[model samples]
Target: MGTFDAEGVYHPRPVVADDLDEATLEDAVVRSIVDFDDGDIVEGTVVKIDRDEVLLDIGFKSEGVIPARELSIRNDVDPYEVVSLGDRIEALVLQKEDKEGRLVLSKKRAQYERAWGTIEKIKEANGVVKGPVIEVVKGGLIVDIGLRGFLPASLVELRRVRELQPYVGRVIEAKIIELDRNRNNVVLSRRAWLEETQREQRGDFLANLKPGERRRGVVSSVVNFGAFVDLGGMDGLIHVSELSWKHVDHPSSVVQVGDEVEVEVLDVDLEKERISLSLKNTQVDPWQEFANTHHVGELVYGRITKLVPFGAFVQVGDGIEGLVHISEMAVHHVDLPEQVVQPGEELWVKIIDIDLQRRRISLSIKQAAEGGDVSAEYRDAFGEHAYDEQGNYIGYDYSTAEFTPETEAQAAWADYQPEVEGTTTADEGQSAEPSDD
Candidate 1:
């Protein structure tokens, strides 16, 4: 019979001389035994599988024993599930012989050893690694790429995911961000892979998305300052100011996650990979709409929304407000807007001037009290009794009209009041001091 060498090569026994000594024959027989030490990797075939371990025939005098714990990186794995009988495999020598006089091998360590070199090369070349998620660890997922790899939850997708359980058993591709063979650690980022693959698509999308162009997108996330919209290829930011035509308390109030909305592309920063969107732009500008329908000297009803040091903010229309300066609050000298109007008080206000460019609308409660032509919106509410055929106000009870500010420009200016109390007039030259609106 032949004996296996250190390299597992079979060699026939040397022919013995007729006068050979017993000690010389013993030396020759011992030399035929395969030479191996701990840490050496060896090839073998599965000869037996038990609940606790698998036996491998590695051409050694005795079969090598692989404990179930060494079968896979996963904990509490069944040995039978890892390997079947007669399957060829590789294992790392852990012990020449334990207390039971058995050769112990580690399959997982051998796999890790082989995978380390390949993983290092891939990381150096900036290549992607493909693997199946084997376990869900704290803060990340574990992938089986011959060896265990960590994929952080934050780097799993373009956006951070809160749940990680669904990733187990799924094969995925990722970029190697960090590798430490000494520590047996490998960190991967699927987001990096996704971003790298989608770069060209994002560029094309940004190129085609022009300013003022309307787009349909889903709200991916809502932050305190803005909402992020997924515009197919990339995410665009809709600042809180652009979320709606009126003051927004928070971005979430205007848009929630997963809400489909039509938005206007305000700006695109290719260098920064940023997209600025405007939700209010796609819809009609309440200010523009108000300007188109209302004009100077038109009477509208309003509710005193807020009182500022310089004037009062009056809501005249949905999401629209106009400033009633202290000078225009009443015909007489007024120390404060509160002297003429209290919050929640409903009254008539005359549109003094509409500066569409500056987004300011000058309104006057004094002029409204003096009586003027009611706005088109109120003309119907009062019927023909409030106006003559010429569209001029004949007579209407100021206490009963339900007109209100209908311009966002008026609303924007409601918070900004001029320190100097002055009249807002129909003549352009007589316009009040332009406050920062």
Candidate 2:
């Protein structure tokens, strides 16, 4: 029996137990039980996995129930795929006690909360975030950067990538371009990261690049003015004029997108971050080659490329054209070049003057027709004479010559010649002559 002493309260009997340790054990159990509230993040060990839910023992009064949908940011995933039994994981308390008196937890929200803090720090530091592409949505992809992050298709690469399915399951690095915690929206750009990396690479590339240095590249894009080539680090422009040794009407005519080409560095503007490239400069100069093998006073066959006010450009070699002045088109003073020779007409022409230094060659159709040795003035000036096998006077007959199909096919100036004397000409125009400089 026991008696109450202090306040004159009634006494209750105390039973004497075989062991007093049970009372201490019950007190220890009460102290071991942890208390949690909604939105609290708690760590636990996965105790069991089920078809639609997972059971985690967070040392609460009851095991915490995590629905499969709340297990991961990825939708329609199996709970087993997200967590395994005995694995330690952190979860957010969704409900201290659900309708069934069970503790409810969400693994995804906990990860999301932690991710936001980390991402904010990364964004401030201008660091890159990497994650796997989990879903392919319209206009973009969903990357698992702790939470779903949108990566637009246009900002996925340096160039727009039409096919986004290939990106699924691939891990990629990106910069956080936008962040909205209230809306739970995050926008990412892989291109930004790539461009930043390329900027550094471009600096190094530009520093080492020298004019006239040959380099290999891939044609990235072709525009009206020029084609842009990716020279490993930066893009250099190949102007339409420098695309070919022959005259080029358009950059696409010489190189197409995705074409691998060898190019010469014509100029490097570090201040402007511009590079001038020449595709034709990397190849042999047709004019130089023709000058080496051909000579003044010799007769060569050519097609009338264009009939200008002053002259007709005649193509005698690949990428090489000589001007036949209107005065030299015929023995009789010619008012128009088309009257004596029409564009697209194959003809023989005599080279009367060659300025190798200037890359200009003066040709004569009338002189080629005249039955005479090289002219006295030309012979006296250049000291070369045009003679036949019997040493008789022989001049080329320009009117009777025909071009081989292969030659006509390869000629760049075979398209549309400029009109002469109000008549529409059907041959291609001559390309602008190479700069003497």
Worst 10 residues of 2 by lDDT: 428-437
Per TM-score, the best of the predicted structures is 2
Cα lDDT of model 2 by residue, 1-437, tens digit: 22435653424357566554546877766876887779999998777788999988787777899999999999999887888766889999999988889899999999999999999999899999999999999899999999999999999999989889999999999999999999999999999999998888888889999998999999999999999999987899998888987878888778888999999999999988999999988788887888777778775677888889998999888778899999987656678777777889886577899887888999987666443343232233221222455432332222335532233322222221121334322112222121111
- Identify the runs in model 2 with alpha carbons over 4 angstroms from their true place: 1-23, 371-437
- Residue-level lDDT for 179 in candidate 1: 91
What residue pairs are clashing in model 1?
A: 301-403, 301-404, 316-404, 316-405, 317-405, 321-410
lDDT of 1 by residue, 117-227 (tens): 899999999999999998999999999888888999999998889999999999999999999877878899999999999999888888887888889999998999999
- Measured by lDDT, the strongest candidate is 1
Off by over 4 Å in 1: 1-38, 96-101, 308-311, 325-336, 383-386, 396-437
Estimate every model's Cα lDDT from 0 to 1.
0.81, 0.78
